[model samples]
Target: MSTSRGAPGSVLAVDAGNSKTDVAVIGADGRVLGTGRGGGFQPPLVGVQVAVDTLADAVTTALEQAGADCVDHVSACLANADLPVEEEELAQAVQARGWGRSTEVRNDTFAILRAGVDEPRGVAVVCGAGINCVGMLPDGRTARFPAIGKISGDWGGGSGLAEEALWFAARAEDGRGAPTQLARTLPAHFGLASMYALIEALHLGRIPAVRQHEVAPLVFTVSAAGDPVARSLVHRLADEVVAMASVALGRLGLLTEEAPVLLGGGVLAARHPELDDRIAVLLAQRAPKAVVRVVAAPPVLGAALLGLDHVAAPAQAHRTLRAHYA
Candidate 1:
């Protein structure tokens, strides 16, 4: 389990999410020679070929930036590899490209786990383009959710917040819901005077529908201003995060033991005091021995660390990777 004797190989670490893809080329010496980013790579929405092509652009750019042709391993944590079958398929496809001597394709959330903890054994919840969670124990037992979007009874993320914000704003404007600052703030975010105007623009295609996800931040801003409805949304998100973490802890019998609870992704990383405080309080209540942390490093760092784990690189190499990534 210890890789103190330095291995000899490079790591091509990829952190591919729904909105952006980051690729890093790291030497065995733990130097991050270069990093590059590209557009989202969602196979379900855009097909497998398009996703691979987009990934190719980012990987090519990173390798070019590093002045290298390939690496020893490709540690790819991708959003599109939602299901086990998908992960296998993508792993085969990536290996066929000969980008590295070996490859590991996993759910993107795993990067959050590897990035935030030194032991690589803990629970991680990611609330980026969507919310997903995974947990691992020292014994290699794991707990994970489908994270297949709403079909899996999932909620809480930028997308979830945006949809709820729009719903509340439209309802408040129509007199069906309690009045709140969201009606004014949500529209104001897009330079519109009212929620109705924003709705009309969205319906008429004047505003890109995808931009609706951007409204999530306004919910936090309004909540901070003491909007009851906005606060409720934030609380619900915190509740969901704790709920998942608690279940994962129970699954691994780590509930009564000291464990790390790592948080990553944009929503949690935003450092909203209200949401952050609630998560901390709830975790302490639900799993008293849990250690909580919000990862500031990009998930690509986690992917790189996992690659180093695969190659059995020395601990010094991990320190070097962290320092370079720092």
Candidate 2:
């Protein structure tokens, strides 16, 4: 449960998320040699072949920048890699790269857990562009969200905020939902006047799903401005995320007062300091002995930590990786 260094050799760590993919290479002395980034490589949206190709391009680019021809090992933590088949496909693709001659692949949440908490036992809730949680107990039980894309009940992340905003806009226009400032706020944020204009832009293919994510920031703005509807929406968001974390804690029997809970992801990390405070307070209310903390490091750094942790990397390698990643 310590943040000590691991063994010698270069490690290549990759974190592929819904928004972007990052690659980092570190030397034996813990110095980061090179890092590279590209678009999301999820096979669900982008084809599996395309995803693999993009990943290789990213990894190779990092290696070149690091002044290395090859790595000794690789650890890839990818979003949407929930299914076993998906994990295998990615593992094969990465191993094919001759990276460190060995490769291991896992869910990005696990990497986030590694990057944040030093202990092997604990739970991490990630509420980034997507909402997901991954946990590992000392007893070897592990759990993660089913990650059923947007079709399933995945409403604790950035996508959820966008969806909620759009729903509100639609409802306000239709007289079915409450009259909220979202109607005016969303249009102004996107430089449109009415929700109708916003829909027009979306239908014309002028707006991409990625652009939908922009609504998230607007949600924060509206909430801060004390719009009743926005405040309720954000509260719902905070509750959903807390529920996700609680599920993990409950399963591990860590729901007691002394358990450790770590909150992470872009959406939660930004625009939710109060929510973080609220989450900690709520955890205490539910289980007075729990230790809750908001993780500060980006998940990519967590993925890099996984690489070193697995290899028993030496102190030099840890320092090099930290420096390079930093």
Candidate 3:
């Protein structure tokens, strides 16, 4: 008896992240028939099998709800697939499950990139829990980052900004740095009396380490209020984003051409006017022809669009899927 579980005309789309995974199944007609959400697919935390199994659960549910047994293409954009080898491994693993006839696995940043642009060409920088960038040109040229944090020489993400906030606050408290509003505000954020107390709480697990990401916005608030240290940190982040884009533009030989630079992830999507303005000014000076746009679409939309591309869906189908996702 033959035992394949799915039909062959649908597209399976998955956007797997560090915190959660989003899955969708789309028909050839551009109808989004089913969507499902599941746990994080971080292989570093949960082994590959567990992460793949988590993805399987979401994919199985999405297909079951769509009343489809299989799909022709699986397009997944996953977090922590920082290396080419990682993407290859994850792609093979996804293909092994028999959910689709073929599969394409890419860094999660590409999903954000593809979602914001009408074309596949341009650059995208995602600054969420961490930061990552990817760029592609019409001729198939591409640029990307290792995005493995300090080891990869990356900076300017929620965790990185939060670390800066705490560093300056601690210094201000000890008179090693200029007295800024953060000295008062950073401790008050956690309902503590001083930086020392807050530090102790975090050290002793009274305040979970994961909560550090919450401090990034406060860093913005202080910067907005005219704290020199805070302003520098924000500008530094803008510099980092600009550098990544400019380098990509150079790599793809698009520095003189008008190309879209899509910004996504929690940090960029928040649209802090000061940070946005700074990024714009720096980009204008650095890469004169790069057009910047903030991506508001969910990353899953990108994954779905990629799947549509995989099946050679018509341009109208892409438009329909974009609007349906919109």
Instruction: Find the candidate with the highest lDDT and give its number.
Output: 3
In candidate 1, stretches whose alpha carbon ends up further than 4 angstroms from where it belongs are: 1-8, 64-68
Q: After superposing candidate 3, which stretches have Cα over 4 Å from the reference?
A: 1-9
- lDDT tens digits, residue span 1-326, model 2: 11112224567889988678999886655667778887887787777777777777788788887877677668889887887688898898778767666788888888778776655577788887777887777455776678666576777577778888888987998799999889988877888888988888887877765688889888878888888788777887777767777878777777764666777788866746656666766666665666777777767777777777766777566565555545
What's the lDDT for residue 68 in model 1? Answer: 76
- Tens-place lDDT digits, model 1, residues 59-98: 8887877777788899999996878899888888888877
Cα lDDT computed for each candidate against the true fold: 0.88, 0.75, 0.89
Judge candidate 1 at residue 5 and give its lDDT: 16
RMSD of 3: 2.4
Please report how far candidate 2 places residue 42 from its true position, in Å: 2.2
Can you give the lDDT of residue 278 in candidate 2? Answer: 64
Question: Residue 72 CA error for candidate 2 (Å)?
Answer: 2.9
Cα lDDT tens digits, model 3, 1-326, are: 11124454468899999989999988886778888899888898877777899887888888887877778899999998899999999999999998889999999998998899887899999899888899986555679989999898899989889998899899999999888788889889989999999999999999999998999999999999999999999999999999999998899888999999999999999999999999999999999999999999989999988788777788888898899878
